[model samples]
Target chain A: MRKLLPYPILSLSLLVLWLLLQQSLAIGQILLGAVIAVLAARAFAALEPQQPRARKLGSIFKLAALVIVDVMRSNLAVASIVLRDRHRQQTAGFVVMPLTLRDRSGLAILACIITATPGSAWLEYDSVRGTVLIHVLDLVDEATWVDTIKNRYERLLLEIFQ
Target chain B: MSEVPVWVAALVGGLSILGAAFTLLGCIGLARFNSFYARVHAPTLGTSLGSIAILLASAIYFTVSAQRPAVHEVLILVFISITTPVTLMLLARAALYRDRAESSGDVPLQWGEDIVVERADAPSEG
Candidate 1:
């Protein structure tokens, strides 16, 4: 089973995306989509990458919800800061936080979450030092940001990816 | 476009306008911020909430009118969500790298390169 489809999720999602793009589920479209998906999977398999095992699928949904809410909240906060708070004593600065999660996929997810938020951006991550440098546009509390990243996202990511 | 009802038209138009406004705000930040590092955040507004609102509008409009569950807009959403961050990260890394090459004091010197070699007595003075 693994031999035929090395990355089942990737293949399925690729097929779905192809179908969604075509916006038709005809027999020929299905066949062609399947072929393309399998080919893409095979091409990806050629890279011989480490397969990240999601230990807990339930946590993934929880994390997604958390991210959506955070994104919404931050969007409002950043917009207000940009439009009105520029003159105030607000400070934009860098934050370096220690990271415990080792999974590459988890780190990638973390980077995505940090960057997607309007005010915060992931500057760099040092795998050797296990630290990530982030920049905040309206930085008020450094410890709070660090705590949020560590507790809110990293903890759940560790549970899911580890 | 003419056959559509007023409310549906209003909803789609409203969403599209909101998305465009968000995108414009993102660009404003790009111009408003002083530094390159600070300006890097300008695109997130466009990518996240902007794309989301516009994509939702597209999906809602097509699904209601076409009467066949149009999800092609979702493809754009997924593509935008995945690619935006990666592009931002790469652009950031490149910008930081370029900035540091000029020996500017804003960015860290030892960033971007992997593997920080630490030794007991190997010139700790900076």
Candidate 2:
């Protein structure tokens, strides 16, 4: 069962995505989608990276909700910048953040959370130093940004992905 | 196929235009940023908020026009949101490797040998 659907959840989601994009469920389409999913799963299995173990699914959902709210807020903020440009605020610079979370998966999730937000991006991570480099689109406060990332995203990711 | 309402059409057109504009902004950022590390942040604008606006517009237009729930676009939104960081991480790692090999001053050169390097100029390609 595992071999056939090495990544069972991923395969199923891919199949759904295929159907959604095509907007059809013909037998031929189903077969082709299945084939593609299987091939993609096989490719994934070949990577053999350490699988992420989720400790609390609730934490993940909570994190997602928080991210959604933040993204929406940032979207409006950025849209305003685009819309009104009398005396534009330039928000492009590098910030170094000290991190407490050590789990690889948690750190990876934090990276995604930061990148997915419109106003900030994850630049790099130094494992030995346990620090992260980020670029902010509207970097008004450095300490606040650090606290937001470390407390908001990293803490929750540690609970979930770690 | 009936004549679309002006208000609805205008809303859709506006949202679509906003999405396109954000995407272009992202691309311009991608081009303008100096270093690879700096350039990494630019595309998130397009992949994240930019795509979301477009996806929202799509979902709204289809749901209203077709007179049904047309939220399938959320799938793409989710996919891109999840995958963009993963791809970016891989590219960053590859770039780091190349930078390290070239003995670039900006990147850290002395790290553990855990990452397998296939060639010297790998980072430049990414």
Candidate 3:
């Protein structure tokens, strides 16, 4: 049973995604999607990526709400900056911050969150040092940016993925 | 056009226009930013909320007019949301690698942190 469904959650989501793409709940489509999802799960298993464990499911919701709000706010901020021709006034630079979250999946999630936000780009991660290098646009203060990453995303990710 | 309801059509138009505006802003930022690192951030304006707005508009318009659940648009949303960051991440890393290899003064001379490269002998954790 374990071998057949090595990633039950992934398989289920992929199946739902497949059915959504099909845009139908017909019986035949459901069976076909299930088969395809199982196959995809096997392929993912073959790739041997690190398995991520979630310690707390509730934290996921909190993170999602936070990201949605942050993304919306930053989008408006960035759009206005571009419109006002203020891009030239601002300075952008790199800041590397130490991270305690060693889980690879947590780091990937952090990378997505940082890059998805308009002002910061996750440039590199140093696994040896548990630090990530990020490039910040409109970098008013380095300490502020570092503190935000640490307090906002890193702390939540550590709770969820670690 | 006559067959379509006015309010739904208006919603689609408004959302599309907003999406286009965001995309335009992001491109402008890309062009205007001072350096590569800074420019990397510019596209998020278009890809994140911008993509969401456009996709939502499309989903709403199609469902209301076609009289079928148009939630299939959610797949595009999921795909775009998942892939954009990966693509941007790769681009940023490639730029950093090139800069570091050339010893360019624009970026840090030494990143100082070491990432443990996955090796064949290492046990794969899943």
- List where candidate 2 sits over 4 angstroms from the true fold: A79-91, B1-7, B21-43, B63-72, B83-126
lDDT of 3 by residue, B40-97 (tens): 8888888887788899998988888788878987888888888888999999888888
Give the higher-lDDT candidate: 1 or 2. Answer: 1
Ranked by lDDT from best down, the candidates are: 3, 1, 2
Candidate 1 per-residue lDDT, tens place, A80-116, comes to 6668645662477888889999999899999998998
Interface DockQ per candidate? 0.60, 0.25, 0.63
Task: Estimate how well candidate 3 is docked, as a DockQ score.
Answer: 0.63
Pairs that clash in candidate 1 = none
Can you write out model 3's per-residue Cα lDDT over A50-122, one digit (the tens) per residue? 7778888789999999999999999998777676665364677889889898888888899998888898888
User: What's the best-to-worst order under DockQ?
Assistant: 3, 1, 2
Clashes of 1: 0
TM-score of each: 0.91, 0.72, 0.90
Candidate 1 residues lying further than 4 Å off, grouped into runs, are B111-126
What root-mean-square deviation over C-alphas does model 1 reach? 3.2
Clashing pairs for predicted structure model 2, backbone only: none
Shift of residue B123 alpha carbon in model 3, Å: 38
Residue A152 Cα positional deviation in candidate 3, in Å, after optimal superposition: 0.8
Model 1: per-residue Cα lDDT over B31-65, one tens digit each: 78877777888889888889999999998898888
Deviation in Å, model 1, residue A84 alpha carbon: 2.2
